[model samples]
Target: MATNAQLGADDDYIVVRNPSKLADLLTARNVDPEVVTKYLHIIRGDAKDCYTVGKTLYGINLEIADMVVSDVGGSTVVKPNRLRPTLDDPTICQDVVSNIPNSLKRIELLFKATPRTRRKPYIVVISTTGISNHGRDIAVAMDKKAMEGILLREIQTGGRGASVIRGFTAVRPSFLTDGKPVGAQKIRAAVEEEGKVAKSAIGYTISRGDVGAWIYEELVEDNAAGELKYVN
Candidate 1:
């Protein structure tokens, strides 16, 4: 079990797309909900589109920090990605509209590969930004029992965005050239925090779209490790 505070050197930070999933993950890791919530503050209970990038909150440019969990009862798993949404794109109605079908399909596969369990795995979405109408629509669509999960990411009106948005590892780093590293100090800093670090490091690197890809790999790896098991 891992707590929000008890991170090891090799520990990788994760983001989930749902709340109930988050609760379940923390329980498995033996993390206290009060403590987890303390680390996370709710901005908009609803949905909106936006994310905070870096120390300053950015508009459409955003980041998602998450925690992934394995279900105890059922092979179904829940993943939570706490985000800071920004409504910088007024014309667009929101900043980000997550690729819903792709995400759901990934979950669907994970569920099928792992045997059935009493614990129905689902998603738990949290947003520093408010939830958008689109986000809500997606959530509703995903609420089917067969899917039997959720999607709850959004942006808020004006809650304290500082704590909620900080300490997050970006899914992608802003700089990377053929596995070689090249970037400004800020990007370097972000990559170091997000990925594995070396003692005699040459430099830092991260790809923006690579975060999701990496997460997918991790999920499969977890399955291989028996974190995702096959029950009779």
Candidate 2:
């Protein structure tokens, strides 16, 4: 239950102990000068703790020294650190249900248990088409079946789960493939409309890398807040 302020004061000495060396290492990595400066500033700030840097900051642990990255569904996901439930990071509560359980109740518990101040915006990925509407397409049908019952429901409308969080940006993309990034030119974002899939959100297959890149750009870098964006 250590506050960010307390963690910062206690950890500053580790980084401040050798700023010049750290700067040299960052410079060697060819990291942007501005990014390096910002990191240094944060390291010296009143809350000199290293909180999460990517997408959402809610489930990240600042105490870890190394940056954490994960390969999820063929996409590389980067987070400032990992969340260790009940140990260092009590803010996160995760559970995997094998058989049928009270999903709503479970989700509700996770939502209500987390402190309001600790909540952060969520970046969710979903299918552009739903099974009920696009059941003809095998991929869309499978996606809908897999996501509709749990992830989509909780994120889109589950009471405290989505409604109580700081904010959420739901990205619904078309079929995904492993290829080069499509870049911004081929990508588009629009407000979600039921039973009406736009041309940009249909008959297109985007690279997994491109999807990850878009999430990083819109959610992490641009800090794009609320709204559901359909991309392809």
Candidate 3:
């Protein structure tokens, strides 16, 4: 993430994760985590509140850059310039707090920070099928359906902030498989404003790596086919 090393660019980069685990996260992306210290700005715990935008602004004078890519597993409730928690509890208002996965709650940062951003960050969310009145239902992946429901409901809510987000694309890929990169070329993908959701042609499966690469192409490479410019 540092200065767009592999992709070739000089930009201030800030990626936060536990120091011990940071290496693995970067390594998964084919980055040499060992040398990251030379480029990345490491955030030690408690020094900065990366959650609440109000508090984080005072702490870091932050900017989420030109784009915010959210790969969160579950959907979140994005408040519309509206009320939020007093103590940063994402699981606060849900009737089924136990049902809300940690992944879903964690995305609270994505929703909260993006709206307040002066830079109109192009937001990309990896969603799943079965989000009511949308993609076909995936009976086996119960978790996916649940998250999709929550996401769609909240986004459709009257005062939700996430709806106001610009350049937002919710990629609803089918059952995600790991271990090998099948590549997006092997699968069929359809894009539409509302006519043909990607989930419609999701097929049986897609690789996580391919999804990531697709994102890299759309944002970093700036594919002429699609839009949004992040310039890695």
What is the number of backbone collisions in each predicted candidate, taken in the order shown?
39, 0, 0
Clashes of 1: 39
Candidate 3 lDDT, tens digit per residue, 46-81? 212333212212113334334334454323444664
TM-score of 1: 0.20
Q: Pick the candidate with the highest lDDT.
A: 3
Judging by TM-score, tell me the better candidate of 2 and 3: 3
User: Which should have the higher lDDT, number 1 or number 2?
Assistant: 2
lDDT at position 200, candidate 1: 31
Q: Which wins on lDDT, candidate 1 or candidate 3?
A: 3
Error of 2 at 119 (Å): 2.3
Per-residue lDDT for 112 in model 3? Answer: 62
Ten-residue stretch with the least lDDT total in model 1: 52-61
lDDT of each: 0.27, 0.38, 0.44
Task: Judge candidate 3 against the unseen true structure and give its global Cα lDDT, from 0 to 1.
Answer: 0.44
Model 1: per-residue Cα lDDT over 10-110, one tens digit each = 23332234667767866976888777664544233222222211111111112212232211111223335324222222222111223222332344344
